[model samples]
Target chain A: MRRSALTSTLTFYLPLWAFLVLLLFPFYWMLVTAVRPNKELYNLSLNQLWTSHPTLQHFQKLLFATHFAPWLQNTMLIALGATVLALSCAVFAAYAVQRLRFRGSGVIGVAIFLSYLVPPVILFIPLARIINELGLWDRPAALILTYPTFLIPFATWLLMGYFKSIPVELEDCARIDGATRVQVLRHILLPLALPGILSALIFSFTLSWNEYLYALVFLSSTGSKTIPVGLATELITGDVFQWGPLMAGALLGSVPVALIYSFFVEHYVAGLTGALKE
Target chain B: MPSVQVTTAARVVRPAGLVGRVLENHHALGVMMVTPALLILAIFLAYPFGLGVWLSFTNATIGQAGRFVGLGNFRYLLGDSVFRVVVLNTTLYAAAAVVCKLVLGFLLALLVNREFRGKRIVRAIMLLPWIVPTSLSALVFYWIYDPTFSIITWALRRIGLLHGFINYLGDPNLARASLIAANIWRGIPFFAIGLLAGLQTVSPTLYEAAAIDGAGPWQKFWFVTWPVLLPLTVVVTVFSTIMTVGDFQLIWIITHGGPANATHLFGTLAYQRAIQGGFIGEGAAISAFVLPVLVGAVMVSFHYLRRE
Candidate 1:
């Protein structure tokens, strides 16, 4: 009996352990390649797990010699700015749909989300012309302007779920106590829906940070380009992939959000699940 | 922000008397809250979405705007052989990805559902591909498919699966297959977790009851599990299909719709023409064609997924 139990345990865990190791190895290799001396990278028989001599030269070059720092800064700035804009717009819209009795409100909610699902490829061509007309090409504000089209509907939907989950009596009591509707929202609903709001912020920022097609198409100059486009074009020259610097840039780019996501995994999944529920 | 009286007038929900005025004030506040979103959507989303429909009729270009050529772009697209290929590729990609993701994710959910040690950690890890920024993950795959010094190539070679080095992206047939593989790798996690959440809501006692009735595992799954999961399956599958069918970044970053345009889905092909090849009107028409189909699919799925 013990033998059978032990065999079953081994059978179950071995595959899972192997799968986990395989899944994580590429990320581990990315770290190893980022740190290993350039000479050791070509060594076919080099140990896959660890390197003896690690250096920060690749990271240094990525930061100083390359334009990674400024790109990182721009991504952060644009992502944050876009997040703020998307959230403010989305939250209000969500609240209005959830709380208010208005004409065509449900239709508007459905319409906005359907609009959000319109692919960026379809939208960016005309938007490029519009941005040109507005004299906003190559500007970070372009992202802030274009991002909410996608972010707002989804964020509004997410916040709608959260607002509906809130008890109606809280607002009723606040209204009876002479709080205006705006006051009730500010004092009661917004504070209560903070988790939903945070999830929206994270999603909006992440979406902005990761957006490539518009950032590539709208922004013309290298200085103005976001990290994804900049790194893809500038970091690797013709016939040279620049593994060390590219991996370093990728690692730097992903660390903040990955950490943020780990911290807010529950809320993040809740937001997605909430949004996914019709 | 606007004329206070005008905005308030817009907000009068049931203008009966004094209470109506107060409710109008609340309605005005709601309008104010919703304005920023409405403004952004109007200019950026609604205007552009409307313009694409308009441009589908005109011969639009990036720099030199062309004269109105009614149905010219759409008519041209219908004849274009590559456009047909793109439509087929997109349909195949979405169908294959959705079907496989459903099957594989369902299996994984079932496996993980069984009470296991370190199940929490496994669940967390499973969500990584979905949570990680797609561009970052795509870059990782880019290197994994690197012509030289690829660990995947090394593994394949070690297993004697292929005798020589495989330039997966450079070969036409292999390139499409490879792009699909990369998409499935990223997509399965979201489907798995979403369906797993749905599965966790299922009562275990139902399974026990099935067991007592002498139902085998496969029979129990078909009768008990499949029906309960159908609605969620439709929702998750349709959502992923819409996103995948219009996927731009992964293909663009990896292959640039390369090796003689073997990997051109509707999104990438639209991008290629609009941005790279500079046939903006034709590109807009292609995407406009896709939009209605997507909307129809979403509406159908959403209608079914919503509980009666």
Candidate 2:
């Protein structure tokens, strides 16, 4: 029985470990290429796993010699702006539905979520027109406006869950102390529910940063382009693909959020789980 | 002014605290708070949704108004060869990817659920792929599938698993599979983590009770875990289906629906038609095709995912 159990464990786990390695190897390979010297990278050596003389030259070129800086700046501006705007709007909407007994509240909640389910593909064409009519086409505000279509619904839903966890009695007691609704929200609810807000902000920021299709379609000028589209088109051209700098740019761009996850892993998980739950 | 008699009226007996007034009157404030959200939704979300349906009936192009050509685009799409293939591919891809994500994610969750040292770290690591940007990771895969120099191919050849070169992204069949594989890899994190959350909510005593009744591991899982997880699994499946069906980035970055239209899922196909091919009407029609399936999935899943 012991021997059979040992064999069963080996059969199940060993292959899974192998598969996991296979799954992760491409990402591992990317890091390898990012560090390897351009000369060594061209050689196709079996020992490409480790860099012989690892250098940060590729990263340097990405940062200094190319459009990487502008792209990074553009991404940061749009992402942060969108996150702040979306969260501000969503917090109020969420607070209303979760805490207050209002008319048509259920309908409002369901309507917001359904809007989130609407695919960007469904709305982009007409939305582009609306932006044009408003004289906002090719502008960053176009993205800001389009982003809340999905983000508000999600943020509202997410904040509602977090708000539910806050005890109502505390707010009631504070009410007896003569705190106005706005003051109570400012001093108590926002601080108490800060974790959920932060999570929502990060999610919204990363989403805007990573958005490709909208950036690709909407932004016309080189100055306005975000990182994903900007780098892909500029760095890669037919046969002479620029892997070293592209990977370097990618690595630098992703590191901030990756660090965010590593540091606040639990909140990140909680936020995601809560978001999905709704 | 003199007849009004400068009386203060005692300020109508103001509440003791600001909180008291707010607590007494939550509804009015709720309306005020929700107004901005409602207005934004009305302008950006609902209006555009209505516009989409309206535009489908018209021959609307980007930055230009075209005449209303009712049912014309749908007719053309019905006759288009590429659109047919896209519909087929999109359906197959969504079904296959969702199934693979569900099964693999469940298994991974089961494995990680076992007691082990550093389990929390493992769980966190498992979610890394999902947390990373999809386009960024897809770009990483693009390099891995490079024809001239690919680490994946090189490694496989070195291990004697592949003879010479493997153009994983260049070949049509292999290209679709490769995109699907990348998606499954990225998606497994969400599903596994979701299922793990569900698993934690199940009472351990139920499993212990089953064991006491002479039930084996499989029997315990079948009876207790499956029933408890069924609702969550359905919700995850629905979410995965919608996302996968609308997936464009992974395939777009990898193949651009290429090697002879083999990887043309609906989202990519729509972009290719409208943006690249300049068939605006046809693209809208193709995008509209997936709406029914998406709505159906949502309705069906809502039936199951709601609290009992």
Candidate 3:
């Protein structure tokens, strides 16, 4: 029994610990490097694992001395705008495809799923020209408008799965009672599918917030940049990497999504696996 | 009484006209409901996609829309040595990263599937790598792989494992390995969680039955667990493969296809040629080159999904 216990520790516990460290060490490093003093950060003699004195100086500089605030604002505005736009469209579309049972609904569902497979890399090049032609170059409206290309497909697909899970009888009964289609959706279907809607909303928000390539391609000016693009481009001038403030920006940039994930991780996972399962 | 009845009838008839009839029609309502999404997709996705294909046939630059030169851009790319390297690198990167992620992630799923203390917390913490913006995490990696002051180098030297600093991103081979490593790091969480969900669906009774048939752990897993997980595995693998192949942000941030253009995937190459270099036609061709592979993957998934 003792030998078996020892073997289990070696085989399972040790490896699990190692995987956790390997997976999470970067985040811990981000936190440590963000707070460590610049002198100690560069000092080879000092302990690099942890800081003797932690400071908020880097956060202050990241917020005050750079375009980080505007970037944050821009990311927030764009993410929220895209989420709202995508969710409203997805809710109605998902309801229609999953519940309305119109002709060609199955084909529409499959097409939407296939559209999710279309990666942004393939589309970004032509999208650049289109954005320019539309006079939305370097504008948040450009992303606000374009993000739905990816977002709506995914949101619609996911919400379709959710709508499938809700019983059709509820809506049928409500319709029999003289509920208009909109009234049925508003009262019966929407209430039961609240979890799914929340999942779609959170997923859309995070996906838009985390979107890098389009943001990188579409927005050029400093004032218009999102957090990812801004931190990547503006923080490092030439070869001199600002490790401190950059890490600070990364930490700050990740916090909102992290907070949202912590709260709604179950929904998030449901959204991810739910679509796949269906 | 006749006037009042006529007014009520008028009120009823007004709503039952064209607008109400349209609203009551399921087909019309479905079309109406799907229009906004379809409109957005048509303008942004479908239109641009077609335009992208058209652009590849031309020699269009950023400002000037050049006349169509059929097959010229593709012919030029086929001859280019750098383009060839990009094709090799992208394939290798996706294949290596997906294989590693699946193996490690399956083991992780197995480990986490067991009853352990603080399991919920561990699972949540495991997802952080995937949940965070990949660009930001890649920046952390960029810092970790710094030439002079890398923590990895410092730790290795202190432990007497090395004498000189290893330039993680300087050498061509090392840079490719580094990028793949970072990709695997970010991607493992997705696979682990996905496979964990699959693992949960397996019944403990099946394992017990396998054991009753005189099976060992490996046999039990092979006979019982593997079958259940296979479908989910195929699905997640296809999804990850597509994402990995089209991956741009991580490589772009880390190396920008540097060290003699060793790390340029199709996405980065397209960006370099089309956006940065302003050879819109060439870039479009480069980006569109991967369409066949993506379509093939989608077809396979569709087939599998249909069978399921």
- Best of the candidates, DockQ: 3
> Candidate 2 DockQ category?
medium
**How does candidate 2 score on lDDT?**
0.79
* lDDT for model 3: 0.92
Off by over 4 Å in 3: B1-15
Report, to 2 decimal places, the DockQ of model 3: 0.66
Q: What is the lDDT of residue B292 in candidate 3?
A: 86
Ranked candidates (TM-score, high to low): 3, 2, 1
Error of 2 at A221 (Å): 1.9
* Model 2 residue B16 CA deviation in Å: 12
B-chain TM-score, every candidate?
A: 0.87, 0.90, 0.93
lDDT (10s digit) by residue, model 2, range A147-263: 877788888889998888999988886766766777778888999999999888777877787787777767778777778877776777787757888787767767777787888
- Evaluate candidate 1 and give its CAPRI docking class based on DockQ: medium
Tens digits of per-residue lDDT for model 3, A1-278: 99999999999999999999999999999999999989999998788999879999999999999999999999999999999999899999999999888988888888788888999999999999999999999999999999999999989988888888888888877766677787888999899889999998998999999999999999999999999999999997777759999999999999999999999988887777787677
lDDT of 1 at A205: 78
